[model samples]
Target: MFKHLKSDLPASVVVFFIALPLCLGIALASGAPLFSGLIAGIVGGIVVGALSGSHIGVSGPAAGLAAIVLVAIGTLGSWENFLLAVVLGGVIQLVFGFLKAGIIGYYFPSSVIKGMLTGIGIIIILKQIPHFFGYDADPEGDFAFFQVDGENTFSEILQTFNNISPGATLIALIGLGILILWSSVLSKKGKFFQLVQGPLVAVVIGIIFYNLTKGSDLWGISTDHLVSVPVPEDASSFLAQFSFPNFGAIGNPQIWVTAFTIALVASLETLLCVEATDKLDPHKRVTPTNRELLAQGTGNIISGLIGGLPITQVIVRSSANIQSGGRTKLSAIIHGFFLLISVILIPRLLNMIPLSVLAAVLFIVGYKLAKPALFKTMYDLGWKQFVPFIVTVLGIIFTDLLVGIALGLLVGIVVILIKSYQNSHFLHIEDKSNGKHKIKMTLAEEVTFFNKGAILKELDSLPRDTYLELDVRKTRYLDNDIIEILDDFAFKAQERNIDIHLISERGMVENPPSFIEFFKLRPKSA
Candidate 1:
């Protein structure tokens, strides 16, 4: 893992910058204390990172679970009760790992996965718009269509336009401009710019701008426009900020439900992240999914115990790690360490960085995920792929991530079934030989109940006095429903003077009494 330290160190720094605001934002959305988010981020990075087999996948507090956490906390009555469930959830995830449930990740279609990434990318861009414009009523980067505050995403943007803070807006624009220049122009100009990431540069400039405007009320910039990192004046004060779990609420049934909710949601999110990270890995390395589940479970268990929100492998952070040229697990591990050190050692400095600057950084990240070219590429793949892709995208945009994926998977399965029905049976006509018509009916690889309708339709369409040959040489499975259809067809064939030839792996028979009995019949004395 440490083989590529030169490349990994720089990438780690990039991922760290990208992860900082996200940790805070997700915590804010989850309705957990702000530091709780940082705790999850730290555990996801340091603990999960060390245990994970994935080289590039990064772990952190996920925005996807914010709504679930919010509801769970309310239902459970106290944050401590919620933490108990989180710990239990982690244990459940570990059991999933041991059970080898990680194989589920491999079953998801690639087209659907791509659509998911694209959909998330679009959501990130949309969610960050208000934050980029200096709107703070909502969390900095909440992506759900409906927010916890009861405002729809679109409505929030409209509201932002009316309640715009001029100072915050101006600084955000300047920060965004600098970020764009750094990424597009400056980074390309020399190695220096590349070594120093654009987001880092934007953050530094934002702090400097905030300081310059602090003394002068003439700039119209208020303290709210600046970063709101909680700064504790002393060690005792900082220690006071940490919240302990309420173990007394363990008997509540709602607590168990919340734990199950976190376990399921966090596990799914982690699986998706593992899949996405594998796709992004330049070397195309496959991460051990079961191990990843266990690692994430451990991270969540630790995070929850510490009063942090549940942890999962987060795609945004993982993608940033990959795009920034992270080559090893060290990048993820180091980022977590940075999270721990920064919050403890330099809380005052971190408090000075503006939210808008982070928004600009995420804007760039989102654009890369949902590039226009990706839509065009998917369309070119034809409707079989495009339909599911579009369905997934729209579902995610209009609803939430899981719902969109469920809808897309449903469509994809229908497509598969339709294709299966078409291929289940085939009729072949042979030239007349000795004044008799020869018709050959070949069954598909697997003729199940689902194929019964198609097979029955073809058999019913056969004309009278047609010499028929039933072939099942390659078939692996024959459902009882299909067996009945064939048995009935044999009786009708005899009445119509249709010659019946049954072919199987064993050999050929001129006449088979019944489909079920045909398998029961032994080869005629070799």
Candidate 2:
């Protein structure tokens, strides 16, 4: 894992810069203590990162769960009570992992997964536009179109027009320009530029800009537009940041219900992200899904114990790691340390970096995710693939991440059912010189319950006294439903005077047994 530290270190720095605002923003959205998000980020990076099987996936607090967290905290009546639920949720996720529920991730079609990534990309662009232009109307990292703060995403952009801070706008534009230059040209110039990324340089420039424009005219930006990490005046106050879960709340039924809810949602979100991250991995490494669930569960447990928000594998952070050249889990571990050190020793220094600079970095990240070329590619794949992908993209953009995926999955399932209905089996008829219709029915490689209707229709349509050949020579898996259909047809074949020829790897059988009995006795077709 440490074999690629040279690449991982710099990538970790980039992910660290990306994660900071998101950690704070998600916490702010969750209605939990600001420090809780940081705690989750720390645990997600250090603890989960160590346990995860995915080399590039980064875990943290997700905006997708903010509404749930907000409601759970309010319903539980105290933040401590919610923390109790979080711990319980971790236990449930652990159970899910052990049960191998991670297989659910594989059920989603590729179209939906691609749609999710593209949708998130579009969201990042739309959501960050205001931030990039110096409008901090919504808290950082709140990408949902409809926010808990009673504001919509596009409206905030309209609002930005009325509240533009010239300092932030100038810094953001400069930051984006620096990022483009570094990534497109400067980074190729030397190893030094490659080692020290554009984001680090952009951050430095932001801090310098913050200080230089301290007393400027209209160009001056306010403290509200800055990245805010909680600062402690003394060491004791710094140590006092951690909070413990109220274990007594475990007795409440509501706590358990909330716990189960978090587990279900967090697990699903984590699984979806794992699939998406694996797709993004340039090396095409497959992450062990069950192990990833276990890792996330363990991280959430650690996070809740220390008063942090529940954790999941976040795609935004994971994609940032991949795009920034992360090669191992070390980058995630290092980023956690960065969060720890920044909050502990240099929080005030962290606060000096403007939100716009972070927005600029995310803008680039978002652009990579939802490149215009991807839209064209998806569209070119035809309606069968394109519809679900587009719907998932739209759903994610209009709703939250989970809802969008669900929508996409729904469409994908419908497409599958349609295809199944149309592709169960193939039939051909030839006129024989002996004055008979030579009918042959060929089964699909795998004929499931969904194919039962189609198979039955072909069997019933055979003319009386026809020479019928039922071929299972190429089938590998025949569902019980299809077997039952064959058995019933076989039982009534004598009444129709239709001679049936059953052929398989076992050769021709003059008298076919019951479909179930025949299948049990003979080897399946290859």
Candidate 3:
């Protein structure tokens, strides 16, 4: 992992700059103390990163769970009770890992996964637009269509148009301009430019811009428009920020229910991110899904023991790590350390950086994930693939991440069943011999109950006095329902004066007594 220190260090810096605001923002969105988000970020980075099999996946408090966390906190009656539920949730996830439930991730179609990445990309772009224009009414990490600020995604964008701050807009444009130049031109010029990423430069300039214009009424950026990290007055106050879970809540049935909810949702989100991150990996390394669940479970437990929110593998940071040239888990670990250190040592300095600069960085990340070329590429793949992909994208834009994926998966299953119904077998007509019609029917590789209708229809439509050649040379597994259909067809064939030839790996049989007996006599096909 250390072999790529030069690359990992710079990537970690980029992740750190991105994660800081997100940690605070997600905590704010969850209705939890801001410091709790940082705690989860630290634990997710160092603890989960160390245990995870993934090379580029980064874990943290997720925006997807903000609504759940907010409601659970109120429903459970106290923040301490909610923390207890988080710890219990982690235990449940560990159980799920031990039970080998990670295979659930493999069932998702590739079309849906690609759609998820694209949908998230569009969401990031939409959510950050207001921030890009100096509108700070909503938290930076809120990804839901309906926000906690009493406005939906589109309403917030419209609100930004009416409330743009001149200073924030000016610096945001400068930050975006610097990012484009550095990524497209300067980074290609030399190794030094590559070592120092564009986001770092943009953030530094944003801080300088904030300090330089502190006194100018028209150009000065307000506190509301900047990154907000809780500044501790002293060591005691900082330590006081950490809250312990109430063990007494363990007896409440509601706590158990909340625990199961978090476990299921967090595990699913982590599994999805693991799959998506593996696809984005340049080296194409596959992560062990069960091991990822174990790591996430452990992270959530530690986070809950402290005052942090629930933890999961997050796509935003994971994709940022991949795009910024992260080569190993060290980048994630180091980013966690950065979160731990900055909040302790230089939080006041961190609070000075403008939110618009981070928004500019996110704009680039969003563009990379949802490039215009991807839409045409999905469309070219045909309706079977494109329908699910397009549906997932629309669902995510109008609803939430999980709901969108669910909608896509449902559509994909319907497409599969339709294809199966039409592709059960192939029919070929042979030239007439002695005034008798001859037809050959070849079975598909695997004939299941789904293909029963197509196979039965073909048999029922056959004419009398015909010679039928039933070939099963390539069939591996034949369903019992199909065999019963063939048995009924055999009786009908005899009454209609049709002669049947059954072809198989074990050789041919002429007019077998029973279709079931014939298959039982032959060995199973490979």
**What are the Cα lDDT values of the candidates?**
0.83, 0.90, 0.93
- By lDDT: ranked, best first: 3, 2, 1
Q: Model 2, range 128-204, lDDT digits (tens) per residue?
A: 88888788878775878897668787777788789888889999999999999999999899999988989999999
Candidate 3 has an lDDT of 0.93
The TM-score values for the models, in the order shown, are 0.93, 0.91, 0.96
RMSD of each candidate relative to the true structure: 2.7, 2.7, 1.8
Best-fitting candidate, measured by lDDT? 3
lDDT, residue 239, candidate 1: 82
Cα lDDT tens digits for candidate 3, 1-526: 7999999999999999989989999999999999999999999999999999999999999998999999999999999999999999999999999999999999999999999999999999999988888889999778889888789999999999999988999999999999999999999999999999999999999999999999788989999989899999999999999999999879999999999999999999999989989999999999999999999999999999999999999999999999999999999999999999999999999999999999999999889988999999999999999999999999999899999999999999999999999988999989877777899999999999999989999998989889999999999989889999999999999999889999989899898879898788666654
Models sorted by TM-score, best on top: 3, 1, 2
Off by over 4 Å in 2: 432-435, 459-467, 483-500, 504-526
Pull out the clashing pairs in model 3. none
